[model samples]
Target chain A: MHVRGLVDGQEFLVKHANGLANGVSELQHLFPAGSNVEDSDALPVIWEKPEEFAAAIDKAVAATQKFVAAAESGDKEAISSAFREVGGSCRGCHDTFRVPQD
Target chain B: MIASGARRLAIAAGLLLQGAAGAADDDLIAQGKYLIHAGGCITCHTEDADDAVPLAGGYALQSPFGTFYAPNITPDKETGIGNWSDEDFLRAFYEGTNPEGDAYFPAFPYTAYSGVRQDELLAMKAYLFSLEPVRKEIPEHDLPAFMSSRLAARAWQLSYFEPARFEPDTTNSSAWNRGAYLVRHLGHCGECHTPRGTLGALLREKELTGNPEGADGESIPNITGDRKDGIGKWSLSDIEYFLDIGMLPDGDFTGGSMSDVIEDNTSHLTPEDRMAIATYLKSLLPAD
Candidate 1:
């Protein structure tokens, strides 16, 4: 949830990269059962197309991995590009898989 | 030598004409594509599935009146509008009449579409015709008994709808006029953003102030210049960036309907057009 906050402000890019690198693996397992809460915005496609959903998660993980390496390099240009990739990965998944919010 | 020269001239003229025709077709299709983005047709036409066929049309739009299923707009011959003539298409957008001369529910936003130029509508049709045809037959609308009749739509049109083209204000800048055209005609932003009267007529006086009961019963935010209630805090760049990527100035990506709009419509617009829209939004009077 705080991924947006961390990735958005360049000041927090380093912190976001660290958090994503450390937390993405755990995030992958968070939706193990495909169970949805009453107020959850997770779309049915997540459960229906498990393979595709898993692939999307893998993309996020891969993007985050790249982002972490870029952040560690301490290069603003590289970090920015990596951060954008990570954001793209997240947005790509959310566009079709997530339930729309009100 | 004279005969050869004459033949060469003929060949050159033919090639020139062919090239000019090709360029014109390309321009028409490109313009159509842009107008489609502005119209946000995909948002309602395509289902919410990740792999949903674009423009295949099975999205169920829940309105207070009823559930209206968007019909397939792809070039499929049987179930879609593939066989619709240019006049058929024009009539639908200009007069809210279907190919069969039946009245269309206002959910199609033809009221705003009526303001679009004839050439622009034709370009839109050209773009739609260019799409891969999908044969999807959407279910008919499920409406309340009182609102189910096509007559109801026709009556509504008589009461509130006006078939008119967008007229530019000579006093405004070209950018402002462009913005007005996009927002008021092609974009039809007011259809959702503006509050409606009891009979679903748009409250023009409160344009862009926001709608409490907007599409899908969601409360749309005020986009006017009100500091507390609207996007007054956002800069022009902020608006442009948000439209492009759905990212707020506060660093949060938007969710819900606006997100879909950003992804499908505004995101595809050129920077100049987005700036034009921003200019128009900024000029609006703040309303509650």
Candidate 2:
């Protein structure tokens, strides 16, 4: 993040974080029943805090919906406007709960 | 058993506290650096293409109006802002008035900068200070006949100078504010999107209406949420993804100025900040 320019770092980090979050959420859904889940190194997010997990997904989805609507409209201003909101929701969730790599 | 649990809780709380403090500073500094790139400070500065001297300005901004020279912003006491007080920096930004007490040209983008937050500006200063200083001097701007005086910049500012800070729309979420800060101040989107007056100043009221007769003759597109030419088809995630990797939702990478923008500025910002800009831009009522 420090070495790369602002836009590159932002784009890379946000996308990677979103990908990680998606992967984690998918794993949460695929967890086997009574398969020593408590002993796992996972953050215990979706299973433990279902409401918050749902809320995060909801926010991200809503932001994405807004963005898609803007983009579909083909309005330059609209797309420019909604795009950042989508990126923000991704970062907001990541910063709050996800641990950064060392 | 309760004591052991309490000890674990205390340790976890301490770690969180440490992370929070360190993260905020890091986040702010990171944001400032990104803003500088979005602002495109380097393209006009650094003469050496090989060496990455972020803001030791030496690049030539050629135009029909004149050939403007970017100044060194490295933290050198004699040539750069190494000795500039915070007040000096703020005055230069907020008023388009430089350390020499003279009004700067709109090319400096102080008009947009006026909307920037003080803390963020300070962070940019911190980041600049942290860079390696390159002692290089740029020649003064060479204007054509009948437009030679620097005083003309003062006249332009007097007509267009409306210095103000960014006030977040209270109804909007914090995410929106983050976006507004990046777009309006740091990104200075209007520098290109907004049309310039006959005197080479931005037409503030008609911002982002498109500039077909722009300086480079390349039309700067209208981005005012307009359905026709605006980016209405993008998802927030699409926008974020595009800004991050310069790849459109349709899998196309942006080239030209936007590519440079993605590389320099938008790509470095935090996801939240980038989204904030996207959100704020999306909220704009469509123009045409």
Identify the candidate with maximal lDDT: 1
Q: What is the interface RMSD of each candidate, in Å?
A: 3.8, 14.2
- Among all windows of ten consecutive residues in candidate 2 chain B, which has the lowest summed lDDT? B249-258
Question: Which digits, one per residue and each the tens of the lDDT, describe model 2 over residues B61-171?
Answer: 655477777789998887777888889988988988878888887778888889887877888876777677777777888887665676888887777788968887888
The DockQ score of candidate 1 comes to: 0.24
Question: Each candidate's TM vs. the true structure?
Answer: 0.82, 0.64
Candidate 1: which pairs clash? none
List chain B TM-scores, each candidate.
0.94, 0.82
